[model samples]
Target: MQAMENGGDLPRRIGVYTVERELGAGGMGTVYLARSRGGRAVAVKVARPELAADPHFRARFRAEVEAARRVGGFHTAPVVDADPDAQAPWLATAYIPGPTLAELIERQGTMNKEQLRSLGAALAEALQAVHACGLVHRDLKPGNIIMADDGPRVLDFGIARAVESTRLTATGAAFGTPGYLAPEQAQGDEVGAAADVFALGAVLVAAAGGSAFGTGTPMGLMYRSVHEPADLSALPGELRSLVASCLSKDPAGRPTPETLLGSLGPDPNPSPDPKTLALATADRPHVAPPVPVEPPADHGRVDEPLRRAPAELSRTPRVMILLIAAAAVASALVGGFLALTRHGDDNKGGGPSVTASDSRRATSQASTPPSTPASSRVAAAPKDRVTVVVTAKSGRSWISAKDHNGQILFDGVLDNGETKNFTDKSQITLVLGDASLLQLVVNGKEVPNDFQPGQVERLTYDRSGEMY
Candidate 1:
């Protein structure tokens, strides 16, 4: 299942939707819980930066978005709006407010035979509509299935096609989740509608409390999918054969969605209400929701200064010092000697003070600090250690930080005027959903970047305060 991180940097608005909070993040992009100006709740998915930058991906995304809009069925979240030409291409769909199938399984254990039949029939019907539109949902797993009040609702359909040939998949990495991907996808073969049926079988296996190919590494899972048989021991005898047919090694051997729908028959028992299921599945003791707090009066003002550490020097003076030192050293080094001096007057009147309005321009011009020899830089701090401070300034932004071991340090939204400090003994990797919303300090120095508003930023830092 894609790990669900809560409360991410909420963009004030995406298109006509007012973003309220983050729902989750996936291979495609971050999904936000947003509302239209008319107050209709919607789930908006913005494409990852790498995907948006590719013309090939954009074309496919535009086409798939159009096709997805045409897909209409009771068992699928309907596409509501899209903007593939935007700086970050995005697609919005009717929001399904319920725990995902994966979350439900985790909370309540595997489903019974009646529930399984209902789920299978609904998903197959959803896939039929998707295929009718000439689109295939490349990724179909429990996480993408929402257990709505009425029934199961498939999500993220048609969007996966855009990711197929992108740089992310250019390295021969498969496009879908490991265990749930079809055998053809595992082997890097051209996939068709049959792939979704294969994934559906795997999802059923999971719902039955077993792995289709058993649990292991991504490579192992794919290997098993391609070369080994699926273990359907957990399924009931009546359902096993149907699921087995869907897991066939050959694409032609699998049942089509229409065939599966016909065979699954009617559900004898309806699923419990989604609200009841959610209450039953609580992972932790319930806590009251935090009280709402008023946003700072200066919210969204670009001129607001980032929360700075007391010991850190002002960015303007530090930059000027480095530029002056570099110029002096360049001229004096010819004599085999170098001398540098700084006067207090340089800070007061030697140049115009950098105001908040000029912050972006000034920082852009002097972002890179003068490089020093490794002996001078690395000797002062432990090479393995790093520290980063992120402060939301102009707006709110979602930020995620991970360590060298792939442990998440923080994953959530940083509200306007909020500050978070993270330190690690090894490398620290950071992802910012809206780069313009925040300022970063690495180690003890301000780390200037030339990130545009709404541009996704990924940065890795080490003890020397250098970004990789």
Candidate 2:
């Protein structure tokens, strides 16, 4: 989970809830932090335009919404409300405030054996409820698991089913994150409850600081998941066998969620007090924000070879070979954006491609300065004003900027080579979906940042032109 930021085009109200601010955006649609009429906080997910436009998708969404609402368990965030028949389909869930498992691992390193067991048990229990409700959490990566005070909470259950058989998947593009995908999913085969177990195993491997299969290109990862073995060397010895079974290539061989819960034993650490959880959250420094990225529309074209796989394997099936070829092509076409999207960053709509001409124009503009000097430009502006110029230097990025009063100034995807400017009297809050994809000039000078690729960032700049 990332810090919420203001978006200019945010709806004032969705159904009975008043939208407060944008929590995040992803392939499915933008998610907002809103409050019910009674002042209860909830997270509302609005479907993307393309998706909502499809009648078939909407039917699936409606059914999935009903199924998701039936899912009940302490480990899952319950769905609060939904209106699939609305102009744009939307679903609301009880808001759980906490950092995601991905953020935790990135900040605090790998969890110990005790922590691993607790997380695994909790998630397995959550899956039980989902499966019992006749649904599967097709996508169960680290980003979808929130570490709340009480325990881990699973999110977006049954939602991925709404995306299945849609135009995107019809073209052979597999949904879900590549690294955590099961072999059945990678091959476009029927996915069942066992697929979630496979993903659970992969997520556990990731939490242990080990890539189940060594990472490379998305296609490479999928190929490996299908044909190779997971590297469990970094996993704790006690739990390696359990995790290994979950990552089994054959779904029938994978353990059920019930089996997983029983095998994980008892939770070693009980949930902490609410006060302790609040204090811990307050003590952490503000870091990069995370927005969800939906699966790319053009993701499964086959063009690139599996760089890490053998050139020719006798055991490779013909159907899988064809699927790999298609995936390679799609990956080659949109690898840069899909790479981040696949990892759960905010690139909903997959964004527009940056052409060669756009790159050349951007390079020319960057290399050439304006006629006015930086000092002169700063001097010319009002004393109590701040100006920010954001340019999509390398690729497209979702950007949201707001004024001190929380008025949104700009909100949308900034395509490569495109630029947007905003001025605020006292302060300007900016949220970049992928900080490394853009260049920022505040006041008259270029703002420097060390943000990594696909890293979402939230920054505030005052009249002094200093970022806080």
Candidate 3:
């Protein structure tokens, strides 16, 4: 049997579902891995008690499940059963196990033309199914998709609408992840299938591979999502035009799902491959990594302002910084279920599995053809150590890593960006904010007076997010 993806902390079962683990958690509820009587493991999402008392909330949740079911396509996670009437209603779907497209990019990164074509085609076909069902998946971020062995599996449908549902909107809330949210949704206008398309555009660019626009910080990404130019700068070649259309400010002008779907089909790998990361210095073995929980701290802690202090890039040790980052990148490659599983085999421990948004990403080359089989799967690979990567494109940017001994381990320049793995040490070299330049600071102190650009240095860190 394939080892669990993100659902490691859940009980053995819940309700009639044999709960295997926690798949992921969201603002409204926690998703668990459970099995049906026929022995199929399912992704079951149960609403939180906070929102369960509201009738409209339950209605919308039910609606999302129904809407997901109506969308007759294999690109989506197949809904097997649901009970919106329960005090805390829940929906269960056949589990498709795999990392998310986001996780895939972090691991494999920026697919070549063939992979892009396949991903675009499969997702477009999925969107066509969604639109045909008279519903819209207001949220279509990379985290919502699994690049399954079968194909791209779209999950978390009804909840977005359920989120937008009037009964649940007593306080006037938003329906989607900020960066991918459409202008209309940002403006609180009536949304339709176009919103999903716009989101799909963002998903495609992200899948094709690019640094996050808003740095995964709430206000900045949301602002950029709404006011910024459709930044497809990271996208290469022919894709830029199509992605731009999906990210267009005007919803009416967006391409129809059918039109987009018609343009996709599998293709062979293309020339000038996207890019390949270096394995590691010949002396060392590739370190396994832990899962990354994208630290969804809140809208307040969004890293935008923190991004403004760009000069700090040179303030810390490159070696320590890179080691920490390598750890994170490695973690992100796991499907987003690591932390929920970390909370460990408990039922009531469901009090909000906290983590950041870019939890996992999955990318794929093949899968089912929009129908037939259901359920997602993953490999039982050994855990990897998340590491720092300094890319070749990172001009003027350098890297530094230091082991717990305060000795510099690895230091170098990332033309764009390069990567390596490290452990959970109190100090580390890291790339700060979203830039390529790395710094060496520990517990908010600069590493050393001699540490300079074009040189390796030592640094430290105590907490996961800061230098020790």
- What ordering of candidates by lDDT runs from best to worst? 2, 1, 3
lDDT of each: 0.68, 0.69, 0.53
Best by TM-score: 2
Which candidate wins on lDDT? 2
lDDT of candidate 3 over 1-468, digit per residue (tens): 222355654455555887767778765578888888888889888876756777777777777777778767879887788888876688888889899887888898688656777787788888777778777878788888898998888887647777654322211233467677774564344577778888888887677655335464333454345434555655665566677777765665578777776655543333422232224333444643333333221122223422443333223211111121122455333111100011101112121221321132111112112222111111111223212222232333333344444333433233222333333334344322123144232222333323222221122344443432
Which regions of candidate 1 are displaced past 4 Å? 1-8, 169-174, 267-468
Q: Give the per-residue lDDT digits (tens) of candidate 1, residues 1-468.
A: 122255445577788888888999887888999999899999999988888888988998899988999999899999999999988899999999999999999999998778888789999999999999989999999989999999999999988778765645222222677778775554334578888999999999899888887664443455346534677777766688889889876676689999998888784444466676667666645744334343332111111112322112123221222222234544332111111111111111122223331232211011122232212332344446786777777655655566665444554445555555666787777656556678787776666756655454456787778865
Ranking by TM-score: 2, 1, 3
Candidate 1: 10-residue stretch with minimal lDDT: 334-343
Clashes of each: 2, 10, 85
Worst 10 residues of 3 by lDDT: 337-346
Worst 10-residue stretch by lDDT in candidate 2?
Answer: 336-345
Question: In candidate 2, how many Å is residue 122 off?
Answer: 0.3
Q: Mind sharing the TM-score for model 2?
A: 0.58
TM-scores, each model vs. reference: 0.56, 0.58, 0.55
What lDDT score is found at residue 68 in candidate 3? 77
